[model samples]
Target: MFIAIFSIIIVLVVLGALFINLSPEFGGTISDSQKEQFSKSEHYKDGVFENLGGVTMSMGFGDYVKGLKGFFGPQINTRPKGAVPINALDALELANYKGPARMVWFGHSTFLYQSYGRNILIDPMLGPVPAPHPLLGGKRFSEELPIAIEQLPQIDFVVLSHDHYDHLDYGSILKLKDKVQMFFTPLGVGAHLVEWGVAEDRIKEMDWWGETSFEGFSIKCVPAQHFSGRGLSDRGKTLWSGWVIKNDGANVFFSGDSGYGGHFTEIGEKYGPFDFAMLECGQYNKLWHEIHMMPKETAQAGVDVKAKVIMPIHWGAFKLAMHPWTDPVIRVSDKAKELNLPIVTPKIGEFIYLAEPTSNGGVWWKNVD
Candidate 1:
């Protein structure tokens, strides 16, 4: 009876996994035509996408088991005791405001970037939760978003860095689809948007170093050191990347999610002296250190990319790692001060004016319990 019970339990677990994989939120697979195109790319190999500099996305069985054992280990201050203060957006003011480009961070990797008479939303995960299933992820750290999805102005373009749930939220996409004029993403990410009901014509799949222009802005999809997959299958089947936007002598770099690497220096050489840079700096651990940058590494990457001002992203939201909720900002600030890098620590929903060097965001998280 023990053997039979064990087999039944295993079957149930397998069925559960299969069900999750089949969910629409998991997204569609790459079609043969898509595969044919991907096969021609320098990054595609062995029927899978490859990271620059040969990164290992797989782990041995022994290492996997060890990781599982350590997965449920104690985390330190994963959530704040008090609410994270939020600054709501002024839609009217924002709509009327002109000059120097403006940005409002919506926490994590989401932000609204305005430049060249265009309003671009980057990784707009404005949903209450980041996970596909409500039970799967923790509640957002903030009490509420400053602005509702419907309240957002018509977005000129939506930029997705990759297909990860946190960065490519399904519900958020649905909300913005009608408002957005176009969608720009790294290759293979268009499948998710299509599955989520975004029109194919509105979606533009860009390869690494691919350039496109819209409304006088030169947008380029660049490399990032990360992997992508929404479900059990399709790992590394899509591309991940950062982006560079330049217009009217103002340049900006958006580091999606990347570890410390020569790519930063390479990007600097190609598009250095950016007016501003938004780099990921949270939800990182030693075990998965190859994909996500530690706080200090994030600061270094900002300098490497020749950014005049650096704003640490991918933090101050739901906790995805074991570190304290505020650890990322603290560490990055220390490193940025050490390097004398101009840093912006904006409160969630606060508008940041890019043209003014004195428009630095306050250390709002320091007062959060």
Candidate 2:
């Protein structure tokens, strides 16, 4: 009986190893040279990326059980009863766009930002599931993207914030590689791009505070209090970060997947008074609050960054936490009102023209169940 059980355990272990190594979705391996290069960043210590300040990510056994109960136990309104509403992209309008910068949120953190004919895609996770396998993460809330990936115009840039499965999807990259002109990612993230067939010259990896330029835009990779990993064993092997995009027309900030921390203040001081900001405002619980901000903090982060207007993102697409689907916008909107911060809640795929910001699509989620 002991030998039979031992054999079963050994077989399982071997199968798991084989699956991780053979799966393309697991992404690329970081070379020793890449590790040495990553070692220069203050955030990289002891051979792994570290968040700013002390962050508590590990939960005690009791907390772990409680989280499991909260996730699997009876829950209400975690997802909408029907398909999420989304606007179909007018490709002609996007191609001929010539005015103040416009953005279309494809739910969650994915966005298509257009300015003067240049198209930038940020965290373009257009897959149906956020996990490597569909069965693991379930389908996205929306039935379709703003537009089909194949129909996208020539992409000027593809910006990535990290290597997490939701933010850096394997299938999306496979579809986007051919049309994308350049790919910008934080340190250690470009390795995955290279492994996935993107040419080395077309990828530019940056450290925190690193700056680069393209055409008329100045792009900077900024700090974020977040962790990174895609597979089971590669946690923190790559860096995570936010981005600051500046041009003659506008200045923008993307808070990437960060927890509430001093980095927000630092980013504000360095590049404050942004014309627009997209801040993460969902997938949070007390058990893992240090890595994901609650809704109130999301509003305050806007103030810290001195954004003229803020948009609440990282919700509306997936049920990563136990809260109701509408809780993020509700809580963040209330806090923004108290703070007197202008917040926009555009429907999935709706065009948000930065110069003429409006919340005319009033409280759309109130009807979703």
Candidate 3:
């Protein structure tokens, strides 16, 4: 009875929110040109939607009942007894983030990269809960962004992997609209931006490998083995992808969120030996393992990109999966050591210098097995 009642409430709230996000008055998503253009992509044109539709129909209402059970299933994410306070990030302050090229893990997938005097943030999920309701889910360790949206200093660009609530929060975008210089995301994501009152000129969209230019940088949306749908209606209507951000001399590959696949080798050969790669390293289980890579697969992905140094991300924010909170980091480290992959693990708010951020030390997420 408890699960059923709460689930109905969740469904109602989510439906109401979706109505606002999808309505012409709220998000101006009535324009159909972007949708027409998006369907031209061979992968999303017909295949992905069919697949997702099939999955949904097969599940029926009963599957979601089971999913809710899974949601409230055994909890495995308790913090370590006498675990380090969130202060390990002091290492960043000790250095004063003034390096030529560096990246800071803001917990989960949010990271600030400073290179060539340009600052870019990838998937800045600063909210406490990835879900719409805080009481209904896990919590963020950090109180707020290390730098608030307004406090962000002349942000050059913001890149998004997809439109999942965890990746694209409405509150953050509304707060950042006036502050950010430009925004880049895969094709249909511009719908959300446009509805949020971002000018069409400021919003740029791309398909896989579709390139667009910023003054000192070039962004290319790359492929990821993932699904996309913020609500029931938008599934596969928008595209999901990883991204390759490049300057003249440096290449940074952000595995926005994905399962390990052949695209790794493809990206490596095309953008190999990257100075730094920030890859997803958490919130995975057998049910969706094909969509989110396990920790050892993350290490293999590092090698696939020919990355010199890998900073494992996507863990330590909200507990989305059953694995112990620290499991992702520990498993990746062990795999990195086994594979001889150079991995740079940093605490929340700590910055990693692209040149050699490893000289000091890394003890960020060191607890789980």
Highest lDDT against the true fold, candidate: 2
Residue ranges of candidate 1 with Cα displaced over 4 Å: 1-11, 14-18, 57-66, 357-361
RMSD to true structure for each model, in Å: 2.1, 1.5, 4.7
Query: Which residue pairs does candidate 3 place in steric collision?
Result: 27-195
Runs off by more than 4 Å, candidate 3: 1-30, 47-70, 78-99, 359-361, 366-369
Candidate 2: C-alpha lDDT: 0.90
| TM of each candidate vs. truth | 0.94, 0.96, 0.84
lDDT (tens digit, per residue) of candidate 1 on 196-233:
88899999999988999977888999999998998877
TM-score of 3: 0.84
- Give me the candidate number with maximum TM-score: 2
lDDT of each: 0.86, 0.90, 0.74
Cα lDDT of model 1 overall?
A: 0.86
lDDT (10s digit) by residue, model 2, range 90-127:
77777777777888999999999989888999999999
Q: Which stretches of candidate 2 lie over 4 Å from their true place?
A: 1-11
Residue 310 shift from truth in candidate 2, angstroms: 0.6
Better of 2 and 3 by lDDT: 2
Clashing pairs in 2: none
